[model samples]
Target: MIRVLVVDDDPLVCAHLEAVFGFADDIEVVGEAYDGAAALESVLRHRPDVVLLDLRMPGIDGLAAIPRIRAVDPPPAIVALTTFDSDHHIVRALHAGASGFLLKTTPPRELIALVRVAADGHTVLSPTVSRRLIETAADRHVTRGETLARLAALTPRETDIVACLGGGMSNARIAARIHLSEGTVKNHISQILAKLHCTNRTQAGLLAQRAGLRPPRPAG
Candidate 1:
């Protein structure tokens, strides 16, 4: 089972999330915290597999708590659960070690799926949030040609995979999209990571964004 800790200052939100988890047999709501300070204490106690965190809190808000939570020996995957999207805070949270950035408005089923994604060691983003990141990257002063030039080491297929990753497609999805087997997609991703000197898919996604690449569709 995927153990999850719900951390939100709003008790209603916490209870709502717990209720959502009840629908998914593979997920268990292990604990809840009202604020970031209490979140830290709960993490130490439960060591959950994932954390659904709220960015704005009374004390030691989600942003401040990110690095501290990540410092734990077996750090839990954190998914920012906030009402805010299309904000720089989303980018900050991602850089600060959050595995996902999700709007509290997310549908319950999708939110539960995102938790499963996090537990599987993949980054998650609300569809709107993903679009915002692509738009934000596109608005940067750097030209697309200039950005793409940095990825000279990648082959054409690797480049395609990177774009898919930027769009937040999972291996299975990418395989179906490109008419390749899942194993092939995974192998390509491994190669892409090695060539880009990235440690994980999230880093590859960031690099793809830096290279002026965006997925054809928003993250699902």
Candidate 2:
């Protein structure tokens, strides 16, 4: 079962998440925390597969707590839950080690699916939030020349995989798009991780975005 810990200052949101996961056969709500301080304690105790974290909360908000949670030995995938898709907060959260970002208005089913996808080592972003991130990244100063220099070690195919990762496609989707078997895709991802020195797929995705590597458009 996929263990999940819900962290939000609002009790109603916590209860709602609990109820939603209670109905899912593959997921179990392991614990709940009212704020970031409580969230740290709960994470230490639960060691859940994923954490649904609220960005704005009373004392030690999600943004401040993310890196600490990630320092835990077996850190769980953290998905930031926010009401707004503010570029500032989104970039901060991702840099602080959040694997996914979702609006609070996301439907329950989609939220569950996102958590699953994140726990499976894929980067998940609400579509609008993703667009904002891309726009924000485009305005940043990560020069293509510098990015290419940093990625000079990658093979051409590995670079292609990185672009797909930047687009937030999962291994199965990348496999289908590149006409490779899923196992081959997984092997390529492993090599990409080593080449980029990224600890996880989320980091690789962020690097690719910062490097301005856009995946090719699908042929109609």
Candidate 3:
């Protein structure tokens, strides 16, 4: 089972998320927290596989809590929850080691799928949000030259994988696109993360985007 912890200041939102997960046989709601401090505690106590974390809270907001939660040994995957797709906190959260961010208005079914994606060690960025994040990075002066310098450490094959990651392709999808087995793709991704010094796929994806990399076009 994929254990999940729901964190939101609003009780209703927490309950609603719990109920949504109740229908997924593969997912279990392990705990809930109303603030960042409690979130850290719950993470230690429950050791969830995924955390649906609200960005805004009374204290120790999600932004502040993300790094702390991620610092735990064998940290869980964290997906930030936000009301707006354009929320600036989303970018910061990703940099701080979140797997991705999900809009609060996401359909229950999609939410469940995204949590599964995160648990599988893949990023969960929607295409639109991905574009915005890339743009935001550029606006913040994350130049292609700098990003490319970092990407230079990767092999050509790993660079292709990073480009696929930039497009938010899951391991299975990347495998199909690159004509490799899923296991090979997963192993390459692990190597990519280590070489890029990224904590997760989301960070790698963003760096790939900042470098303006794209997946190769399909062969004729």
RMSD in order of candidates = 4.5, 2.7, 2.1
User: lDDT: which is higher, 2 or 3?
Assistant: 3
> In model 2, where is the ten-residue run with the lowest total lDDT?
132-141
For each candidate, give its TM-score against the true structure.
Answer: 0.74, 0.85, 0.90
Query: TM-score for model 3?
Result: 0.90
What root-mean-square deviation over C-alphas does model 1 reach? 4.5
Ranking by lDDT: 3, 2, 1
lDDT winner, 1 or 3 = 3
Which residue segments of model 1 deviate by more than 4 Å?
128-130, 135-164, 172-200, 213-220
lDDT of 2 by residue, 1-220 (tens): 9999999999999999899888789999999998899999999999999999999998999999998898899889999999998777887888788888898888888888888888897778876575757446432566767767878898888888888988889888888887889899899988988887766677677778778788766656
Q: lDDT (0-100) at residue 39 of candidate 2?
A: 94
Candidate 3 residue runs with Cα over 4 Å from true position? 126-130, 133-139
lDDT of 1 by residue, 148-206 (tens): 77678888778888888887788887887777899898999989878876645776787
Which candidate leads the pack in TM-score? Answer: 3
TM-score order of candidates, best first?
3, 2, 1
